[model samples]
Target: MFVSELMSTRLITVELDDKLSAVKEIFESVNIHHLLVIESKMVFGVVSDRDLYKALSPNIGTRTETSKDTATLNKRVHQIASRRPIVLPVSATIEEAIYIFNTHNISCIPIVDHEMEPIGIITTRSILKALDEKKITLLATCKTQ
Candidate 1:
């Protein structure tokens, strides 16, 4: 199946200039693990709960200054977020999505349209659910046969 068949259409996003405090609030309020960073409706990068907390933590050794003069404790997401994000087109097949996820060691991928505009997000959980459902269907078909 195509990614659009299993991807979540309801997306929660944040902008690069948005305050870390606000991102934290959204993370708590929505109970979501990750948020897509967007700019001009285009996918920028992903920010996870861990990334936010790491930024907020007062640990000295972890902090790195950004171009905006803000300190990031978790430099990984912060640095990546400063650049254009890697995005997958919504028309991509599940197998292709799996390949990207496996090869990149990324837990999530933003689904974009032909114009590279953000549309939705595909996560490991979503893929697992689709696989589980397919397994169940196969088992049922085998029993019937």
Candidate 2:
């Protein structure tokens, strides 16, 4: 399967000056685990939920919204986001994605166009879901065949 076939087209992105507080809100609103940090129509870094948790003192999800939490969240996303991320083209195969996941300690990868414009994202969950669906389809076909 191709990455484009299963990658999510809906993207959540933040600029350098964007706040972690805003990121927290999006994280809570969506079931996503990663956000692409973009600048000038190009991806600069990636900010995972784990990264956000480590940057916050008490973690934003907790009800303990202390002044420190507010202050820390107000920090620019660029400050807490992991920079210089490796990206994949939408034409890449799913096996390539699995290879990347195995070689790197990353759970999410950003999908971009040839011009480096962000188009979609692929996560471990998406890959698993696709694999399971494909298996089910194949099994059903085998039963009929």
**TM-score, candidate number 1:** 0.74
lDDT measured at residue 71 in model 2 versus the true structure, 0 to 100: 85
Estimate, for each residue in 1-145, the C-alpha lDDT of model 1 and write its tens digit.
Answer: 6888888988998777777767767887996677898778878788877767766645433366343434443244444353555688877887788778888867788899988788888888888887777832443564699
lDDT tens string, model 2, 35-124?
999999998899999988888777444786777666887877988888878789999987788889989999888999998889999998
RMSD of each: 5.9, 4.0
Best by TM-score: 2
Q: Estimate each model's TM-score.
A: 0.74, 0.85
lDDT of each: 0.73, 0.85
Q: Which clashing pairs does model 1 show?
A: none
